[model samples]
Target: MAWPTGASPYGIGVRDAVVRGVGPRSTDGVIRVWYPAHVPSSLAARRYFDGPDELQIMTRGLGWLLSARGVRALGGWRTRGHTNAPPAAGRLPVVFFSHGFTGFVGQNTHLCERLAAAGYLVISIAYPEAAASICAPDGSSNVMSAAQRRRLVGDQFARAMVRLLRARSIDAENRAISEVTAVDTLARENDRWSVHLTAMLDALVPIDQRRARVDTATAAILDAGDWSRVALMGMSFGGSTSANVAHLDERARAAINLDGMQQGDILLGQDIRVPLLVMSSAGSMLPSGRVVNDLHYESRRTATGRVQRVLVADAGHYAFSDLVAFGARRTRGLLDLGTVDPERMLTLVADTVTAFLGDALEPGGDSGTDETEVSP
Candidate 1:
């Protein structure tokens, strides 16, 4: 992808590959990793899992689709470029990126690429049964039924089953679960789903056995003395996942949640010790904005001391993801989305997130800036 104009003082690097040993979830999906590449260094970054063959084929297919749509919508298809490694004397900070519900890691490549360019090693995980894996080369092995393939997985399936049964009791129960469910349940589900999601992450572990094994990979990477800091970020449900991860993962120094609803104990129970930043939609902050208000209130109450919340003037939740301008443009209207210029929205998110991480993780980095001011 094209680096935003202006060279990064630390320079930038890019690498992409399918993490193996991960998917094929009933449908087999592979996780993709984009990290700061360090070549000719004494220590080589290991490659984790070799995803199942079917999964690799599936990834290629999805990649093609995304590339086509992205080019048509974004004006150009940006290719990944190469850069020099970080000074061997120090290690780079690490950032884990989680995608929205039913979204793959590649969906937010634009944002993740920007973070990578800004001198951080970024790993984006693709959740199984939650992402669109490519179909096999012969156009075979794509097995998800039409219903299962829909973006809104469980809810759609539940509604269809309820309608087919014509069972009022079932319908009522589903509605109650939807209405009365606690946000903590959502957070717990995020953790639970991660159990399966870890497979995709396995691909990032270098193939070498000496450094560490798959089980201890994440810990090993986080504990590296060379790593100056660590941060977690996500959008929508992924944003909520980041909150849960930050609350539990002591290694996480900070977190950024992009328009995700707060659920479970994250809001009602646990205290967030690390610095937290919440970016929401301006429309969602208006009189009828329960999601934004509830999250803002809960975050304020739970944050120990450091917390920041801002509503992008004309942006919507999807603004943080590529869906607004990359996918079917019609999808934008489906959310009753507000009109934030796409380029401005992307820059606002990138700059705000960079500033947040800089202040919280970088030693002596500037942190006092408030809302990032972008012209309409």
Candidate 2:
């Protein structure tokens, strides 16, 4: 439950808002936004898991003793952001974050805090339907979707999808994946999340009065964001969401997917022209023992865009998330976190992502920060 001590100078501020999506395919959405802010020394930082619903989601309904212990540990941890603090001066770049499937909004709070400290407005979107659980300020928790819950616990549909992910080649993967109509469910879900991402963008549009209402704090924070310089980033299924949103939204100058297997129509010949950096752990292997970049390889081969790939050494699937820093100590066997030091992994990930986004969104690029650098 430890948080990363980031190097940025700006104090962080966070606020949450629920907005109804204006898109025909969109749904009501919850977003937690972190931004650079002015904080007084006397301000008290908020708890990591602040309320009942968040605590329930984090502890998985407090079903296991280990989980309860983890929650107790988390209770002592504090976030870097002050709730609804004054926004820092100057319009900053915007970056949207999506969480993995079955993950709640704050799953990657460490990364979001790091980005917010680095002077970007970071909006972490919550997909209540697909998330393990998401508690809104209104005291309602949207639990996991029954269909997605079945998929997670290994129904026939889930097994078939896993088999497709292990296919030896793109053609083989695509051919097999096409036979399953249920794959459309992923496409539909991706569309929903992507639409939610765009809806957040719509909220920032100064003239979009027809969209959801923005509160005073939300308005001030959104106003400080330079929407023209926007990027998308996420972990796990959230990573897949980032890639798909970048492909569909022309405003996305760059995207980073942290170790998620690709899903959605992005695998079915849709070209992504945005600059994308796909970071992988050392362990994404196919059935034939070849360690592949999965969608990264396919995007590099056919997509007319700047695509860079990096594989972190001694890392596992969950290493890109905050789960590595906290729950890994107790749930290591279940979560399969990488062997790298949690703090070091968090620093490496934050540095790499910050460097990439700085170069992609800022003028003249981020001087000499090595976007490809990784720690041993």
Candidate 3:
């Protein structure tokens, strides 16, 4: 379970730092920012939630699983020949990442690291309630109740529907039932957590206020002139979050959804001005036909008319995240959770994501390419 290694490129440097206080959560939220270390550029750091202890516990849970599978941090990937940091004056493009429900921000370390190696500033945010963050002297703690745990699992199913709805247009009867079922299921699952997720959304005195706070704070840190472009990405629940954020946030120039289910107003088809990229696991049990239709609908209706869909052959729902291999090995009964070959699966995800991000965020930059088969 060694951490996956990234391929380094010439003239590009990489470094990472954890930024605190970007969200409203009580805990000090972190934004792991990665960028080319050779330039003298300043970039705004992206932020996410700061509250919800359950999310932190979930992150730890995933980490424990990874560690059990032998995935230790191998340190940062700095170019051996290039010791000087990149100019800090020039801003690099920015990309924000959200993890799957009950997932830690670093679950997709392979993909984030590869994007960093390609000369971009990538920020992966941990949604407090949605992520699995662990805290304990020995790292053996379950912060969520049995019900909360179930909601976390159910959130995945809800997101699957969101992706499905977005790709295809539903017929009159199907649309009504799909929307009602999706909303009803989500509400039922949220109730299990005492409707914590719903409460957060409802508590926003003025819905726009929440958006304003996040926007103001993020804009201040991320206003680097060189980082002129921005993108959003997520997995599972994170993917749904990305779609929601992209729909509402004008700052995002594009978005990528990696096998996440969508919920709430996000599924109703809001206007998306930027490009949208949808990636899915070819072997997932979720309905691909529905997802394809939603994607087609969004692309055709959106102002940009730019939407791309890709399927990773033989990949499972967890293949896009670091959880696939790590979870399988660590959790005794989780073998059937994802594809068996973890390293290869990670490589495929990393390569595809890097290429897609490069093309979307840094149009002029060299978009590196890699070809690898998806393994189950």
**Per-candidate local distance difference test:** 0.53, 0.70, 0.50
- Of 2 and 3, the candidate ranking higher by lDDT: 2
Task: Give candidate 2's error at residue 230 in angstroms.
Answer: 0.9
For every model in order, what is the number of clashing pairs? 20, 1, 43
Q: Per-residue CA lDDT of candidate 3, range 226-276, in tens?
A: 434767788876776676666666666677778765545443554455566
> How far is 293's C-alpha from truth in model 3 (Å)?
6.5
Which ranking of candidates, highest lDDT first?
2, 1, 3
Select the stronger candidate by TM-score from 2 and 3. 2
Model 1 Cα lDDT, one tens digit per residue, 1-376: 2334334543334333333344533234333334444445453322111134534543433444344343243333343434223322236677778777655655666677676656677766655545554332233334233354453435644554344334245444334334423334343456665554344334333334313423343333323323447677888777777776676666667778888765444444345656778787764442333333343324345345556677776776777776555444565665435577666777777888887887888763423324432335
The regions of model 2 sitting more than 4 angstroms off are 21-27, 51-53, 56-66, 145-147, 152-182, 210-212, 267-271, 287-305, 328-330, 363-376
TM-score result, candidate 2: 0.84
* Candidate 1: residue 226 Cα off by (Å): 4.1
Worst 10 residues of 2 by lDDT: 364-373
The prediction achieving the highest TM-score against the true structure is 2
How do the residues 1-376 of candidate 2 rate in per-residue lDDT, one tens digit apiece? 4466767778988887766544332224677899999998888887787655667655763234235777667645788878888889878898989888777677778888988998899988877567766666666566665465656443545766676666877667655555432465565666777776676666665435413365565766787878788888888878877887787778777788898766654544444656677787766655553334443324335345356666776788877877677664557656777677888888888887887788778763422212242447
- Candidate 2 clash pair list: 1-326
